[model samples]
Target chain A: MPAPAIQVDNLSKLYHIGASEQYHTFREAIIEVASAPLRRLRNFGRASSSDSNIIWALKDATFAVQPGEVVGVIGRNGSGKSTLLKILSRITEPTEGRAHMRGRVGSLLEVGTGFHPELTGRENIYLSGAILGMKRTEINRKFDEIVDFSGVKKFIDTPVKRYSSGMKVRLGFAVAAHLDPEILLIDEVLAVGDAEFQNKCLGKMDDVAKSGRTVLFVSHNMGAITDLCPRALLLTRGSLQADGSTPDVVSEYLSVATPDGYVDLRHWKSERSGDGPMRIEAVEILDSKGARAGQIQAGEPIRFRLSVRGKSGAKCNLSVAIRDMMERIIYNPNTSDDKATVTLPAERAIVEVSLQENRLARGDYSASVWLGDAMNVTNDRVHHCLKFRIEDSSLGQTRSKGLVRTNGQWSVQRRGL
Target chain B: MNPQSNQFTSAMTADESAPAAPSEDIPELIIEAQKGWIPIHFGDLWRYRELLYFLTWRDVKIRYKQTVFGFLWAFIQPFLKMIVFSVIFGGLAQMDSEGFPYPIFVFAGLLPWQFFSESLSRSSNSVVGSSSLVTKVYFPRLVIPLGAVGGCLVDFAISFLVLVGLMAWYGIAPRVGILMVGPLVVLTVIASLGAGTLISALNVAYRDFRYVVPFMVQIWMFLTPVIYSVDIIPEDWQWLLMLNPMAGIVDGYRSAILGKPFDWSNIAISAAVALVLFFVGAVVFRRIERRFADII
Candidate 1:
């Protein structure tokens, strides 16, 4: 019965807002203060000052984590993820409920939290370490390692304001990493660094997890979350939506977040909304069976099925895009040679464009469909309507590392004199 | 494994109690072990008193760093005000200082008022000014204003020493009542913190506190008997004005620094109001402290 690393129960936070309901002038304030109870009694039948501005950031959120368990928290924006973290971290008190945590909790909610512009990077390391709840000896023991890890050795003695943004973020992260707290709550801090730096951070976090310290990681990057955390809790619109395996939750999240690649913009929530009658009806990625979904490899065989229609039966040039999660187009299939014309029957038409092998790395990507009139007759239409996910594993279900193990040929040769 | 690893015995006990967390161990159970100890606790504030000291020190250092005249800024403002008051009131208005030199009368009043005004200005905007720290991490929200208010003591000391210099040049000696300077100084600090905390908390919710502060401080200056003696007011009306907490504190400062009588009746009223203000300010601050992270 190892004591659980963290326990939270029946937590709820309620915020009361103010309306124009004024609290009397000075003379009236004195009289109101004297008769507050009487006033309340008189106006008990109706709400007076507050016009129902009570918002609950969390509602009965109860969960616990064991020691050394690295759990990913998956949630949409405003899903109470940040609020839960804040309350647990004690940035603010839970409106109702108690959280019992064992050991110091180090949080990287934001980088460079306490760096004074006038203080040197070296001084800031100690200052931030202390703020993170590390003692002097604790910081002293790991000071050199933190500096080395941050790769800011050259700028360690320079004032923090003088350091580059990367240098500042690195120093802030390094101090947080070396804190050695029993529990760590990190909010996508690795997001600050470059790809190589991010890779290095992932490796370090892997080591942190292996060291048997409990960690709660929150990130919108499903790849990072799925790679690092085995278990995850998903929140939607402020309630616990799903609590299960990382792959399961992420897959669930992606399905719900499937951008309104649907043909009609009104029925669908389109990412790109704009002028005139131009809107994406639907975007479908089908398999050889013509099923709505096709299991995809990063850069392998796949098909794009677009269903777009214009207000009139006129022919329209089609433009399709394959954008990665960061919104960079990984593949675009709207060139002249491979183009297909669907004399859209007035209101609706289906266009299917299939490639022998879809070349993409294993991850989530969005399928975009756009429509314009023939001979440059109308405005351009670009909309991300449907969501597509590339599974690295033939297992197709496991979200293991967000990265797939691609088969590449390699050989070693030696030259002898 | 090391021979003393407690490997065999520890493993056996692990079944009964969590090994990493020593549920039965007195020290291990100090903070709750679930979800990692609540990221913060009210008790933690008491534990981290040294951090508060260092933060206050940081504020003082940061304020003085890279400035041209360094600590002299503390003395320069009050000294300038003292001369201006002495010239205008002592020379032109010819207001009596109860026989003591006019500058001495005015400087003693200005000294506490200046500390009050400076501390209030800094503390009122302290949370908003440090928005970088407030919204992201959790520390006692009280620390920002406390540090800003506490940092003023350094400036107060620097300027207070100048008063001794001015008194020496004037060849005036203080009476034994100077011992009351310590309590009077404390009273002044309490008055400013009470006002600053309440205002700063409100400042976060309504950004209008930014516009209101300098305007309020400007008006507050006249309400207190800084430029003139409280004796200038007819005796009957003095008690009514003493409701402004600084009135008693500023008057008390003049009493201790100069040889004036301790105005106990007025001070008693100010003490009651100051204490009430502090309690009121603290209540307002605590109630709003939780919302700052979300709203601010």
Candidate 2:
């Protein structure tokens, strides 16, 4: 057999938590170096104590992917999925072990990573492409195709700052998608742009996978993962928990957690990205009678009480999405969808949302919250932060198959035979 | 069925016949923890030569994007400095110019001096300024500072025109010794890049190191013979002055243009120091570069 395209053996990375917080100054460094000998003498013969500031972001992760294999990396926040990708892409050095990659490797850790605001779209294409490791000749060959895919041909000569945020994201993804490497590593860059553009990107990725190149995809969207990747790896708290077929690994991930009726968002252990002027401090799942419940009956009405914290007179667009165990988003409810406006008071306030019917089948489900403006800026977001279960309806005990349950009236009339 | 699939199939068939050839064509990349005293990887830098060009282009393009004067500012900066120095040092102090006019002499010296100073300051802050690139992408860290220095070459070329205009005004044509100016300018770049790379690496770890740069450049100008001629110094102490790499470069430019006798000993000493500084700076930069993404 041909050699594996990527081989990772016992890779690990340790990060210092509080040590990074301290300000590093030349004066302090000089003093520390000057006093090193005295300090060593003072602590002579004493065993080195474990420093509390250190945490292993990744530990003993060993995996290999054969050529033409597509693998999905799925994990909750701070679970080492990104850390693993970063190490493989050589953005950060691993603390121990080694990784061998055969053939050309291109990583899209972030889109628009080196895009300059002052540069025109055409110039940024070349600049960002070069930064992403594409040669000039390769970029020249694919220039027209990249621009056509992005749909920003009209503004190709305009500065990037003039483009809308969605336009920028599309252009960024366009350049990255054109990278024809033997091995591709992608992070969650698909979680941008409108739904239609996201579909376009996913289609392009599907084409890339079909071309028989090795790929490692990391995303919080389980539906995308199940659709694109045949095999998957699951990480939990910096450790590889499971590696198997996509369905098995996803099921293993979903089964690892118990449903929660309430979650404290303030101290939630997740990687959140946003410029937060407003935040979702906490969330509570409530039944029809206003009591906390971890499991609700299908077809029953459900309510959510969100504790929001922000400055007074701050306007926010709040959206909550509910997904089933397969992590396919069933439905989303947004305040802006109803043309309703929300203004937060100083400190903290509770905003409640009520749904007429859960309309969900018997299965485990999760709810993710998002706080942002009417524009594309996400002030705060927590993915799959709250989880609950939808039990069978009281009338019947049959197991359900699909994601949603809809009630329909049936009518029949006798006709001439 | 489509062209894309047809290409894929053909490539797969070819690969099946020559499995070992592909590996031989593209070397495998092995990533592990870096050990002590990492040497500079000139091969990796060479492989990423295109990125260096693009980065340098970006810097030069964005520098004068909205400015009304554009490249004229490059000439204006050194010209203004030359006028002020000629008045103060040449007129007020009556310092000797070794036979050439003071404006021409100082202008010649300022041309290389400004290049060195500008390149040094820009490169010293380059890594910190491109924090986004450093943290998000992987390339040779040396390229950032090198690109910054390269961008200044355009400004230096533009400023060289002003020196020619000044020499024309004084009716002092350059002699055959002017050919040596090319090597002298290269020596100046080496010295600037050496100090710049060292400081830029340190600036990533200690942010306050940025403040030290302008102050250091100000003091460094005095130590070098930019505004004054080195002939005024006693012959014995001239060797001590040659320790500053720019002293020899500035002296070399004046002698090259003014047709004075060459100082081989001083130039040789300066070249030696410049090479040593480059070596030390690159060694230190490579050692600390592995932690840049984490800390930055």
Compare the candidates by lDDT and give the number of the best one: 2
Q: Write the per-residue lDDT of candidate 1 for residues A1-417, one digit (tens) a residue.
A: 787878878777665543322222334446657899997988898778554456576777888899889999976555678878877787766767777788767777987778898998888887777666766666776787688778889988888999888888888887887655678888877777777777878877887787678999988677788888999988765677788899998888787655332333446532343344544456667665556563555555677766665665766667678776555676677634455544567666666777766556677766666665565333445455556777664645443443234445899899788
CAPRI grade of model 1: acceptable
State how far residue B169 of model 1 sits from its true place (Å).
1.4
lDDT of 2 at B44: 90
**Which 10-residue window of candidate 1 chain A scores lowest in summed lDDT?**
A17-26
Global CA lDDT computed for model 2: 0.86
Which 10-residue window of candidate 2 chain A scores lowest in summed lDDT?
A46-55
Off by over 4 Å in 2: A19-23, A35-50, A259-386, A389-417, B1-24
- TM-score to native of every candidate shown: 0.75, 0.82
lDDT of 2 by residue, B190-228 (tens): 998998899899888888888999998999999988888
All candidates: DockQ: 0.24, 0.55
